[model samples]
Target chain A: MSGDLTARSGGLTLPRIGDRALWSFVGRRIGHAVLVLFCVATVSFFLVRISGDPVRQMLPPDATAAQETALRAQLGLDQPLLGQYVSYMTGLLHLDLGQSLFFHRPAFDVIAERLPATVTLAAGALVVVLVVAIPAGVVSALRRGTATDTTVMAAVLVGQSAPAFFVGILLILVFAVNLQMLPASGMGGIENLVLPAVTLGLYSIAMVARLLRSSLVDVLGEDYIRTARAKGLTGWRIVTAHGLRNASLPVVTVVGLEIGNLLGGAILTEQVFAWPGVGRLTVEAVTYRDYPLMQATVMFLATVFVVVNLLVDLSYAALDPRVRLS
Target chain B: MPVLEVNDLHAEFRLDTGTVRAVNGVSFSVEPGQTLAVVGESGSGKTATALSILRLHPTPPCVYTGGEIVAGGRDLLTLPEREMRQVRGNEIAMIFQDPMTSLNPVKTVGAQIVESLRRHRSLPRGEARARAVEALREVGIAHPEARAGQYPHQLSGGMRQRVMIAMALACRPKLLIADEPTTALDVTVQAQIMELMADLQDRFGMAIVLITHDLGVVAQVADKVLVMYAGRPVEAAGADDLFERPRMPYTRALLESMPRPDVPGGAVLDPIRGAPPNLLDLPSGCAFHPRCGFARPECASTVPALEEKAPGHAAACVLTDDDLPGTSEGRRVSGT
Candidate 1:
């Protein structure tokens, strides 16, 4: 039995696909991501232009035609549409997003300053999602048809149907006003982070938990799980070491898309919670017709969406050898 | 003493429709170093009987109505889940039909083997890893070190079954319940796996409860044979004796169904005309009577007991002892 124990044909060939092959896959994905981002930037520029002129919206109500004209020229809103498109595209090439009309700073700078806040909000919401979803999904799958599973399913249903903004207000009314436990609004320490994170993550948490529960439940019934049991693995090991990794594939895919969904929906959530984030800034820029800031926000979110999906695909390859084969 | 003794094992599925008595009063045993083949068609409770030994049946749906699966001096039926865990991989290991679906797709074959070894033996991590590779080699998998590092999809069907055998036998359990282990492989690969299993049994002195419908497999490896029909054993005897003189009509039909070289070129293969009776609502008497060619009026009203018609040879049919084929009238086995 111990004879012919030598490794086959030289160096490591075990990882399904090698580093160069994986990197090449990533390179192709990056190429696709650039194309998607470029399309979003172009579409946003035209789409935002059709929302009406920022100059007209910013002018005084009783102002004369000449005053409106002067403001338009000063803001470069008077330039021809294609000329404006050229300048915007040129600015993007140099990593410059034009001046924010209201902030009177570079549009990139305005969005960048708020990036940390949005990042923290997204990170906290994700942490909340995983913390809540993992145990809920796993327990529900393991204890299927039990009261605990039914209760979790019911709770997840309520969470799925409740809008983020509505959830945020209800949380504010209960936790902040009634209990006097947490701050009602604005950003600060750990205390301020909890409600907004929960509110923003509510729908995603529901989605992830539901998907995970179903996925895990399906995986637990697989032939290998019975094999695991026959091997004397009980309780946690069978569920975790044998089951969860396979179950997480669908959840991982959903999470990537949900994070993109989370950011888009963060606009309403930030409005309800009064938490300053790029989402809130994007709303502000839209209200005042700040085109550059609007374009910048679109670019930021589009970039985030693209990068997240790329990571998810890469993770799919890493998690399942079947995926790597294709 | 026998390594595994299953007595009057009864198991049922409690579904919305009704209770399904999958295994009803099925009894068999296997001495150490022996192989007992449970032969039956699909849904004949062969798989259920095999699963009952390890208490691996799905519980919400499956309830062990009655049984004693004795292994290593303990009734596995009454043992708590915690103690059952020790008995499972440590005393009796099992392998399934499809090697493709029987492994964790996300895990390497070696890691899966290492997991069971560590679980049962509490081997140190490095030692477990080394044994895992050796186990792969023992199963006749070429380049064991390289194959160990590869995932299930990376290996062929035969290679994966070898890996499964390695995993099941790594701890050298007293009994191994192989449920149609060769059913999913190529014809040539099937022979190779069967040979590998027989060789391993010789080396380890492990008993086997091999559940299969293929009579060819039973004829090749079984020391003893038990034929089941609708969850009840209809015949039990030494393998050679059962083939030579199958007293039960169902067993006779099963034997006749096999394609043999001895049969002439123009001779057609016999197929038992009807389906096996449903477990949920089995026919009143002998479950196979509806399908039996020689079935009589009494066969429908009376369930024949599996009594020993000869020393160590039992059959459930009500045919008289003197009803030999050449001397018989209409009740002969070859009448079909």
Candidate 2:
């Protein structure tokens, strides 16, 4: 009987695909991400051009036709739409995003200068989300239906519903105006990053906590958890080793997506706090019709979004072996 | 002395609608190096009885109203949870029904086994890994070295079950509670796993409390049988005795229900008429009265205590030996 069972089950054995397949899988995902970025850039480039003319917005109302034409010629705006598009693509091929109309510098260089500030804020916000949300979510799940769970969930609900701008102002008023422990606006010391990061991260924290709580709560009820308990594992070990790893798969995906959201949505928080990040630069470029700067910033954000999603997919595959990249 | 003795165990589930008496006045003992099969249909409290021994049920919904689970002379029901942790997986290990869901998907089968070893034995990582591989090999897994690194999804149902058994027996636990371990596998696989378990039992010299609904499984692996009906053991007897001379009506009905290959073609299989009684609203007196073919007027109003019909075979029923159909004619009489 044992021999028959083994012989039959041997046919059901999974073929062990080697590391080469894993590498190819990652490579294929990267290729897909790049293709998505190209589509984003193409759509945004034409869409932004159709909205209005940057030359008109940059020039004074009293300018003569000659001056306008010369300015347009110099900015290469006088060229046909197809001609302009061709040049834009050519410039992109050479890693050039054209010169900014407002800053009178290369659009890439202008955006690059502000990139660090946005990255810092996003990174800080991610830290806050991880440090605060994971523990809160785990506790809420472990102590499900208790007073602690109720209180934490209620707080998360409020945090998720509240607007970023509203939260930013509130934090400034309390931590900046009332107590004066930290600066309300600008980028300088670690204290300066606190308000904006918290304001921007509050929603993400809430989202992560909610997602993790539900995922973990569901995981805790799984048969494996009971098995873990039956194995004489301590409650803490079972939760951390067995439960948390499975629960973290969804959380990782959410956090990766949230990074893109944090970068794009940082515009409002940056404006409120006067943090000179790419988000604020993008807004300024739009107001002044600095087409190159605006296009470059939006494109940069799109690339980041696609790349983050790719990373999330890779991490997800790593966490769950059942997820085949193919 | 018995390796584990469960005395008058009363377990309930406190639900919003009402209390459910999942296991009521259940008592049994598993002696060293012996196999005690607790057989019952679904919702008959076999699982509840098994889990209650380890205190594995979630607290809010499940509560042990009364019982004494004496294992190694300590009452497990009243033992501190901290100490209970020591007994579980160390003194008395358990393997559940579905091997697919019972093992953690994220963890390697090797790591899982190693974890139990390290926890109980305090073995270092290097030694634990070696022992984990040895355990996998002992369960007849091919390529124990490579298999240890693979996740649960990589293994077939039979192999996964073997891994589960490997983990359970890795610590050399005195009493192993297997709750329908072969129910999730194919017929051939079930036979293989059962054979593997019996082999492991001989080598380890550990008592096994095999909880399953399959009479065939009980007949093959069990030395003694405790037939449960509606959260109570209706009959307790040596395996051959129970099969040869089933005293309780429910037990007789169960035996007749088994599909016999010897029966001529086109003959219909005899199945129990009604479902097991709902734990929340069980009938007064004998819970099987509604379904018992030999149910007497007294059976409906007064419960029959499990009493010795012979020297060691006990059954709970209102019928006497004269009232029961003889062993040779039992199947035909019950079917009609």
TM-scores of the models, in the given order?
0.95, 0.95
The candidate that wins on DockQ is 1
Q: Which stretch of 10 consecutive residues in model 1 chain B shows the poorest summed lDDT?
A: B327-336
* lDDT by residue (tens digit), candidate 2, A69-153: 9999998888898888888878887889888988999999998899999999999999999998999999999999999999998
- Give stretches of model 1 more than 4 Å off: A1-18, B324-336
Model 1 agreement with the true structure over A1-326: per-residue lDDT tens digits: 12212332111234334567787888898999989988998999999999987876887789899998899899898999999999999999899989999899999989989887788888889888889888899889988899999999889778879988889999999999999999999999989989999988888888899899999999999999999999999878898887898899899999888887776558988888888998999999999889999999999889889988987787777667677622
In model 2, pairs of residues that clash are none
Error of 2 at A113 (Å): 0.9
Which residue pairs come into collision in candidate 1? none
**lDDT tens digits, residue span B1-336, model 1:** 989888999999999999998888988889999999999999998998999899999897999999798888889999999999998878999999999999988787878888888998899877888999899989998788878777788889999999999999999999999999999999989989999999999998999999999888888899999999888999999987787788898888887776665445313577898887778899988899899888999999999999999999999989965663642122122211
